[model samples]
Target: MNRFDRFLAIDWSGAMGERQRGIQIAYLDIEAGTGPVLMRLPDAKNWGRVVIKNLLMKLARADRRTLVGLDFCFSVPWPEEGPLPEGEAPLDRVEELWDLVENICSGEAHYYAGPAIRSMESAFAPYILCDRYRGDEFRFDRFRETESQLSPKPASIYHCMGAKQIGPGSFAGMRMFHALRAVNDHRIAIWPFDPIEDANVVLCEMYPSLFYQMAGLKRAYDHETIQNTLAYFHSGSPPRMSIQDEADAVISVAALRALAADPTLFSDPRRVAAAQREGWIFGLAPS
Candidate 1:
């Protein structure tokens, strides 16, 4: 694994709109003692996926060794028959799935607001159906290392309903991945799939809850909660943050910083195959 000069965390949103309040970006330089700082979006409202993609490409073009953690699943559990349309050969690799989803789900916010995914489920064999699966019956990617450990358990990428669900975010994120790969003329690497050491920018899936637990903090979004979490990362001193910002952004950056400090968290010999196909969360330990 390469040592990154900068660590960035994106708290992504699945909510519909040209802009969303749930989206936020935070970063910490290896040398900045003040700790993580949230990047300001223009208009101080919400960030559109296009704006986010441009900022990332700008960073890659600058040749900065950066590791970006986006809070969404990279891929869902591989269905028994694969995600390809009928008669098409099984996807030879995970990048194929990214291309497949992007090709099918492009121009549709949150992957056409669920219907696109439903269509996908219908077209593929051994369907990972979104409307039908519930609870334990829902399939999870083998690389979802945090699901068993996190509370309420992580929902399947197919479960697209109710509060605290990750389905919509994962859908939107895969579309963003497609856009990001195309925007820079193909200069980025989704980790474990592409060679991290060779890519200009490394992108990984991240879960804020994992970091929040490691920091010994509750999942609260208040001023005091955010301040206390910042203190954990800043040698017991709180970093300044705007109350208007969401707590996940702050927690994500801190979690990313922690992952950067410890190399072992990124290296798991046993899950290499799973990581390439299903995608692993950055800091998850192998079962």
Candidate 2:
């Protein structure tokens, strides 16, 4: 259980655009202990899904032991009773779902998952909530088993409420992860799906709210509160962090560093069998 050298936190977005302004990536070097700086694309462009993949590849090549936490679910739920094709059985693994989404969204630009979401609505609708449509099995309070284990209880990825929609990001993220893994160059390993032993880079699901709670930031929007959160992780605060997303990215990485220091962290995953397809949030035990 060696520690990762670098920790990165991705404040991801699932917006419809070539580059989403909401997307942000921040990193900290455990050894350097100086920064958790926000990353930007060249020419001041916004961060896009494709750009994120490229960055992961570059990090993998560098061979630094890195831990990346994407602010999205790595996988979705697979209920015992849900929509599926006429002959196909329920998906048993996250890797397969990643490929399925990628193939479905091949025509989608920037790995946006709009097309896939529409095309596969029937199969996943039972879990996802929409304004006009809710699957036969859909329940407003329904969420994956892993999500229910959190303290405050996270919003369901199945829920499509604006400002709370996290499902779309998972679809797009799976596509990104699939592309990174499909290269066969072995640039990355998706945690729990792939073992962490000696891997140069590993990515996992992250929820900033969990880190916020852990950092004792009772008020995330307050300037002093955000600074205190950063200070808790030994970041001591940086500049230009007036927005919530910026704080999320910076605080996330710093928290990740502090959390990773606990060698026993995530050593035993709860509900292991189910977490195989419904990925667990980082720093939480699957339930």
Candidate 3:
């Protein structure tokens, strides 16, 4: 397993907007001997996906191994090809899935993927159960094998409705992956999709809730709970955070630093072949 110089945890959001307040980023420097701090860009309060991408590019170019945990699914379960444009062939792999998402959401501002999703709302209507996009075939079933390994069985990539629905973030994140790959090559790698032995930056899926659970908390809504959570990782209290997202980010990165060194994380994820295309969550064991 590779040791990282820095750990970044993002509480990502895909809500439609020019800027998303729910998207929070925090990082910890392994050599700094300090706690995780919410990353504040020079002029941005809320983060736009494009800005996040640029930050990632800068990190990719840096000559240090960095572990970045993005709070979203990397790929959908390969339930056959989603509704494709006429004459387009079904995608064979995750990168191709990213390309398809990029094509569908091209020109979308703030990297919002509403258009790409709305385009397929009809074909996948049965899977979506949200009030607005509820499909006739909506059934709360279907999940990647890796996800099924977790106790709660986090939402399926196909679940596009309700609060747990991370489908929007998943789709938008794919576009970011595609964009990063187009420019950076081996500098940055999304684990389980792109090989990572020589990459300076590596990205993986994260679920902040898992870390909070480790500390016996539900959410980092208060400073005391935040302190307790960080303490579990031997980290100091986070700087005063006003929003829940900020607290989540702070705790998450601290947890990432604590969990990144496990050798199992760098090993094969599961028996399912789709796992290569549909990535695994970083800290969770595939067993």
Best by TM-score: 2
The positional error of residue 278 in candidate 2, measured at the CA in angstroms, is 1.3
Taking every candidate in turn, the Cα RMSD to the unseen true structure, in Å, is 3.9, 2.4, 2.7
Q: Order the candidates by TM-score, highest first.
A: 2, 3, 1
Instruction: Show the lowest summed lDDT stretch of 10 residues, model 1.
Output: 120-129
Q: Among these predicted structures, which one has the highest lDDT?
A: 3
The TM-score values for the models, in the order shown, are 0.81, 0.90, 0.89
Candidate 3 colliding pairs: 125-135, 126-137, 126-138
Predicted candidate 1 versus true structure: per-residue lDDT over 1-287, tens digit per residue: 43887888888877677677778888777776656777886677777666777778887886667889898888766545665445666786766776777766665763433434556443332334455443333345432444544565666666566666676677678777777766654457787566666566788888877776666877777766666766666533334555433567767777677666676666672355656677777777766
Kindly indicate the candidate among 1 and 2 with the higher lDDT: 2
**Which pairs of residues clash in candidate 1, taking residues 3 or more apart in a chain or in different chains?**
none
Q: Candidate 2, residues 195-273: lDDT per residue as tens digits? A: 7766788888888988778776663767787788887777756657667887888888888877777655555563376
When summed lDDT is taken over every stretch of 10 residues in candidate 3, the lowest stretch is 79-88
Q: What is candidate 3's CA lDDT for residue 130?
A: 54
Model 3 agreement with the true structure over 115-225: per-residue lDDT tens digits: 655654333445555546655555566666667777667877667767778888988898888888799567888887777778888898888888888887777588678
The CA lDDT of each predicted structure is 0.66, 0.75, 0.78
